[model samples]
Target: MDVWEKCRSWTASQLQETGQDCYYQVISDTFDGTEVTFADRRIVMAASHDYLGLSADQRVREAAMAAVRRFGTSLGGSRAISGSLRLHEQLEEQLAQFLGQESAAVLPSGYQANLMLAPLLDKDDYVFSDLSNHASLDEVIRLGEAKERKFLHSNMKHLEELLTTTRAGAGKTILSDGIFSVEGDICDLPALTQLAGRHSAYVVLDSSHDLGVLGPKGAGAAEHYGVQPLLITSALSKSLASVGGVIAGPAEVIRYLRFHARTSLFTAAASPANVAAALAALEILQTEPERRQRVLNLAERLHNGLRALGYDTGASTTPVVPVLVRGRERCLRMWRKLCEAGVFTAPMTYPGVRAGREVLRVTLTAAHTDTQLERLLNAFEAVGLAEGVLPEAGPPREYAPVRITRPTMATSTARGEEP
Candidate 1:
């Protein structure tokens, strides 16, 4: 049999032949932050990670353009070799301050930032991770030489059990996402950090989806929980409106990773334009509180709207909202119909989720107008009713929106002390 036989006979190809594949189709966006054009039709963009809606902002665009004009695109080499720039250092310093960390190190991507931990670990170490964390965090555990254990998703009781009975290692680390992307759920960060402290395990919060959309100050999950982990990792591509990622923590750890980790030493430096744009977006995220506020307000709007429309929006408290469709084929059909109705969404299936927990992942931005949201809701109402995803929806019998609370008290850290 040909080694390529399985690739040639994949199920996705069949879905593509019938135009049911929704994953990689081109957007041909009109450059507006809130909408996209596809097949000559304008659609409200309900599935995107630009939480603060700064990716298409004119100020961000101008910063990117100015950087490109001055530095030309690529940095030409890795930072350890010849690509280190003063701008990179400046961004790191600013990020350190913003994240309440002593230091920060930038990487080529969030995936790279997640991978940074692997080089710092050994056979004597172990990592306990959430089963529902982002894929990048999952890869860190899977590829690392350290023994890895998966606790139940957000079950602090289960995590404590694993930490107590699992092999007593030379070192222990807990890995989790600030926002569990697929489930649209926020991690019980306070509980997780408390467990980490009791176990004397280091904590790593992967804040890929929450950097600019959570916390009163927009410092992601650490800030949200009033705790500082051993490290916090996040991507600029999501909220900072640019490419690349950063790991923020103590000065010693950042220094160690900068020199030892192949993620920073071997990978080419991020382009000047992307870095500058991210710096500018970070400035916006810091100064403009309204943007992140708008994101949460809009998220509440969408989440409550979906719940009232008789759809199961499972445990979402952030901008990432997942509307459960239950069946693979039904989920695909819902996505297709939503797209046809000028509303775009992401479809989650078996490998991305569990066997029966398929959903249409819907995300909103600060840039989306009320009319756009209403339009999206209307599309849902129409398609949901037509597809039997909804049954006689005027309002759900009981609708309870998740309320976000800002707890000012600090939680436990790696050493069982407040940072």
Candidate 2:
């Protein structure tokens, strides 16, 4: 407790001195799909996870409105109590079918879905997880009190060694993210499944960022690899452009979780609007294949452009492109510069990635136009060269280049200097 208190104080004081928020804080006055307004300024929205841009779609909006008119706002209780609605049932059925699973259960959020499912494994069972898995998955493994081992991020050799050393007859479960949120690297599901088969382990995949963004029909990594995991969990907030979490798996497992998972049994059912919006999003995902391709194409262009500018975008083949910056100071400065350039992106520093591997996490979406992409690239080039992260684009122009500064507590007040 004393250490935690000191740590909290240290972080707060450091951020105060540096004029940094714990995470980048943007007070957006308005946002559609392509751009977000921060008070009087509009920034091209390159930091959003709304991959398919269905969040602002008229059809999805209309579906939510209709559901609200019919069912009011919420179901008013947990599903175990009075909260279960036909909409919830309908969404689950749709999800199960979409993922090619036997059944599905929708939860309040993606975090809760992992939280509820992870503890179902017995305390004596052995669980193996990737070090880079979502925090919720790690939390639930702790909650379950199961004997768990964490392998190095995506290191199959380390995983294999751990699997070999586990108690011979103990139940084994493998936990991993389908698409790592920060770095945007994909899980090698085919390789993971092969390893799971050898060890007889049940694989739990968090497809939160993959569904509606991968595979021929957007069924996610499982379909992309032509393999299925024992359990698949995802959030409806990302590509679905709605809100809620869902787990799709065997009917028996879902039935057991329906009653036993505390998060599901205690939390209120998903609101009418969210459920209906998710249903509509799912429909759009199937019908509008172009949305998926558009985002991917934009992502490729962004990735190629960043690499051309000589920025380190670690292992990403997805919409989540991370421009790696070396230290905290440079990373923060880079973020501030990009913000000044009217482009918004998320910055990852200590405890998110390793100490020195800070990155500016840029997310791409289908709604971004070619002109917007060009603007983004130009901003990156300007900032990258200014920060000495990239070489000069041309052979040294004679004119003076403008200087940008990351605001500190002492520098924050007078001119509305952005951090």
Candidate 3:
């Protein structure tokens, strides 16, 4: 068979390996916060991005409804045309203040936000990105047609080396995820920003998973690390419980993007309801710091429990936790077992993560209760042991002297007691 036909045949093997429809699902009872009912089977949702639980907030819902009542549903054209509204401007201003930025612009989606920001780079510019940066950013780099280099994930030395070797006068832009989605590790933003300053490079941080969940007041990884990026991009759909994206930076840059961002100029603007909902969610994020703490607390509990059970959760220090399952087939089995036991989680396979480093990404939210968390813990413990992902339940053993020459070859190096 030809290459295309051979690849097409591999689709069947993938389906058999992963079990069909692992991603697509419909939850009945839309307002349910921590748990979802699928086909009459209730499951604790551990694979969602609603970190602040603002998606089900009454105030947010009411605000959205109010917007719909006042402005109707759709904005017929792009923001630059006839789609702009008072609420859009209000949301941008509020986001700027919340994120400690000089200005902000709202877009149709987070993917679009990156897509628009990318084209700002000229032919004489170069883009440097972390290896684990989001797919959107990678796509943007390709679309922008700029010379690019990918540094090792969170490796400042590699980035610095690349910067030192680049053409002296060429403009440089660094793209990275403030909090990696699958690994759930915060970027070394302070070091990255320092390097950017030294090399005259602009840093663009994708804080989609960090905002409304990271930092003391949920100001994102930049605030958590006490560093500032040249531009910040995020998804409101994740924590703000809305259906749009935001790009925030200095006023002049935002002004330029407001006109040059073709996605913003060509696509319809975010609905008034989404803008109002995001505004409400932002207010809640500001007023209720406890909500952020709750999510973090739950995450810590889950992480500790998994560790105690001798399960490998790799380098996670945030609400998004990845249970390392190693191989694709093993991860699929673990995920299936968890789902059957009433815990829902998403699996990360090749391309989403490195080969042989598959994991189940479990996201925690403020709305998740103690009972729910305990149940999830139990499910993970049971399923992990059953699938050989963890050692058999037994007393923890003292660490043995072992050397890891290559960090990439090692698995589950996060804090743990050997079993």
Candidate 4:
């Protein structure tokens, strides 16, 4: 009956004691986009979110260092108060233009970027969201206290059916993740926006995993679909190699959110170094479009290689590849084996994904060379074969999504093992 009661059961002591903990607060000695040194060993990294691999770039490092010198690291206040820098203004303006939006408001993180949408929803508003949309969108609706209706993942027919329940005059909003991180599938943005238009509902697209990674110009899902959403929110941490988030839309709409959204007005502004890092990364993203293409090509290669080896990589067309694993225990065992084989990948369970829908999260970045990628595939094959994740001694075989059979290993879902 105490406040600390719940946290008592959240400990990972059992997993650690049993040596079943493959990842949870594990220390990394050093990470340079593609390689991560940890546990006294250097391994090829396939778990980083830095999709364009700009984090370790000397140019990005220099930009961050220069900003630290100029702005003294922290700004100490919210952007609306004493924290707004000329650099912040420049970044916002440049981002808006790059994304083909009228204006942008920067936030401390992508989580806050989505939470700020709370102010846009009202009690009477009907919030239609995809089942697999990022957790932040769900929290925003809860905070907004709107009528929530979750349709199946990327199923527009279900979305339209829900829209039919609401009147045209109702205050309705459609929420979705441009790229669903768990399964590595792009959203049905074209169908979503069209449905919203018919119902006169506003659309909010969370492109946290899509920005600087998808679209013709890398402007994200909306740009790829040739349709415009009422607003787009994304993280700068991934492709931009920085630690913050941004929401872009029409000028007046952005201005309204800037003033009304407490998530932005109350939170301390993003650090100067982080903002500068994102701005510099953005510049590189635009000037060197080849990096974008290279990363996608590397991802498709990895995806094809895994599928050819008879693993189920569900409907992925992007760099985020989720190799669906079976049980929590077996998943950790496979991860440990891959580590022994000199590779590192992320482990996702329960809250990170659905309880039964566990996976070993593998990511591809432009920083990874073809040699390193091949090494990763070799490691996966070895661990997968040893773990009975794939058919033994089979001539390189291809498996369809539904055809791949996932074998469940007996065990537990460790505490705090969230993606």
Candidate 5:
């Protein structure tokens, strides 16, 4: 066989032998409130991103239905062509007002928005990205030939060091996630903004996990920290309980993006029903501020309870909490045990998290009751203790120590290897 055929065969063999397979266990019924039925059991969902639980709200459903009746289903063309609808315009306006921005442009997905934005900036520009940024943002930085510098996760000091040391020729931009999806730790936006300003760098904040979950009125991390960036991007899938993405920023930049961003110009716009549903969800978010507070309360409750039960939930302050299992086998075993106990959770492994740091990610929603929370806690404790995955008491031992050695300056021709 040729080299190509040999490589292909090897790839297939590797996948068959070593791939950790994931299968979608079928569900038989609709999602009602906080419960979902699969087979003969009703599992309490602790894995979804419906932070404020607006996905099943009557108002949102009604709005979606109304839009379906009026506009049918899909937008036949991209937004630049014939897909731009009145509903889109309305939602964009509402989002801009809510985010305190001059303008906003809705995209097909958060992934696409991130992928499209980095390429639009000139190649001479340098993108200072977070080391632990989401895969989508990482892909953009990698695929585009933009000069990329990764700083330690959420470390403002390291970011400033890079900014100060970088050559003046490159146009600088700092990109970070407002709320890290995995660690659940929030970015220090105030410090980041100060550094960016000092270095004359543009800032791009991705609030995909923070939107509708952080801030005073769920305006996101920017509002929480009182720092406005040059660009803000987020997804509607998580908090809005819909499907789409939005980039909110200055009007001129938005207009420029509208003309140049191929993902927005070429791909079909979001469905009419989804757009209307998101708008209604936003309306609810605006009027019912207590919903956001309730979700926060539930998150706090879960975090405290989990910590008390001797699980390692690292530095999380948002609705997303991760039970650090640290090994792939252990993480999968915990997930299977939880599933058998009628509690669904998403497990994070290998690429999603760092190697030797796999975890079981638990997300909280406002619709979940106190009883459900207690049930989840019980299941975790039972499974963790029974399987010897978690300790009975005391903090976990350090995994491994890292040693840092500074590079020493060498004189020219001292080693006699190179001039």
Candidate 6:
């Protein structure tokens, strides 16, 4: 065989041998709130990020259908050309207001937003990133190649140390997730904001998992901590139960991004139906604060219950709860068992998490009823105990502990003043 053929054969064999196969499974019918039917069984869903549960809400559906009736499916051209619609503008305005910013730019996807923003910075600039940031941010850093330095996950002291010591001239951006997707721990935004102020750095907040799940009014981490970021980027796909990304900041920054960001300039804008759906979702979020409270209540119940049942649910303070099962095979086994018992969840292994610290990532939605939450708790308790995977009762072991320390502000040299 020639070189190309040999390479293809090797790739295929490696995938097969490593159990890295990717395929789609068809759901028998539509998802009913927090339950889905597949393979002649009804499973309670614990793996969704639909925090407000607006994905199947009647008002959201009606808005989307109305848009579809008025405007067909596709946008037909990029946003700069014939794709910019009134709905897009309205959504941007609403998002800007909701995020407490002067303006916001909408993108097709959160991944694309990250991909576009990183390359916009100059080569001489630097990015101070968290070591355990989402893969999208990792891709951004790799693509930018802009003097990247990583602080330990959520370690503000380490971040400040890097910022003070690095010699990368003027432009510095601190990028982090407001709420980590996997571990579910909240970021110390106040400390980060103070550090950014001390170092004269711009802060970028990715609130993909926090937008509709945190804060009193579900306005996200900035509102939760009373800090305004230089730039705030998030996905509507997760908490908003829609499809798109938003980048909110000052008006000039948004205007510059609209004309220069590769993802916004090159790709077609979001379809009218999706834009409408997201708008409706936002309206519902503003009107119904109960949905947010319900999800938080359910999450707290689950977290406390799991601890009582002797399961190591890491330092999670949000709706994204992860049940730690140490090995890859054990994690997969627990996933399969949970599925067999009519509870569906996603298993995290290998590249998704560290090698030996696999887990079953369980997320909650507001649509989940009290009975459904109880059922999910029962299923986990049963599966964990039956499989002998539950840790012994008492103080839980630290599966992956994150420690954050604040940095002292530096004294300025001019006239011995503290800036």
Per-model TM values vs. the true structure: 0.94, 0.90, 0.90, 0.92, 0.89, 0.89
Q: Which candidate ranks first by lDDT, i.e. highest?
A: 1
In terms of lDDT, the poorest run of 10 residues in model 5 is 410-419
- Please list the Cα RMSD from the true structure of every candidate, rounded to 1 decimal place: 2.3, 10.8, 7.3, 8.1, 9.4, 5.4
Give Cα-based local distance difference scores for all models.
Answer: 0.84, 0.82, 0.82, 0.83, 0.79, 0.79
Better of 1 and 3 by lDDT: 1
As a whole number from 0 to 100, the lDDT of residue 55 in candidate 1 is 94
lDDT of 5: 0.79
- Candidate 6 runs further than 4 Å off: 1-7, 10-23, 391-419
TM-score of 4: 0.92
Clashing pairs in 5: none
Better model by lDDT, 1 or 2?
Answer: 1
Write the residue-wise lDDT of candidate 4 on 1-419 in tens digits.
99998878766886564334654646577567788776778888888889899999999999999999988979898888875999998999998887778899889899999988888888888999999988888889888968999999999999999999787677888999988888888898767877887888888888988888776667777776666788889989899999999999889989988998889999999999999999999999988878888888888788878888888788767888999886777777887888889888888776677767878989979889999989999998888888887889862654553321111231321111111
Model 3: weakest 10-residue lDDT segment is 401-410
Worst 10 residues of 2 by lDDT: 410-419
In lDDT terms, how accurate is model 2? 0.82
Q: Candidate 6, residues 1-419: lDDT per residue as tens digits?
A: 57698667768667544434321455676574589886789889888788889999999989999999988887888989875888999999999988888899888888877766765567888898987678888888877757888999898879988999977456888889988888888888778878887777888889888898776567787777767778788988887788888889889888987887667788988888888999999999989988887888888777777777777678777888888888877787778788888888878776777788677888878899888888888888888877887754633554333221111222221111001
Residue by residue across 165-261, what tens digits does model 5's lDDT show?
9986678888899888888888887778778877878888899888887776677877776678777888898888888889987798888888877
lDDT tens digits by residue: candidate 3, 232-312:
999998889888899998899999988887777889999999999999999999899888878877887787777777766
Separately for all candidates shown, the number of backbone clashes (residues 3 or more apart, or on different chains) is 0, 0, 0, 0, 0, 0
Which residue pairs in candidate 3 collide?
none
Regions of model 3 farther than 4 Å from truth: 1-14, 17-20, 393-419
Q: Model 5 segments beyond 4 Å from truth?
A: 1-19, 23-25, 392-419
Judging by TM-score against the true structure, name the best candidate.
1
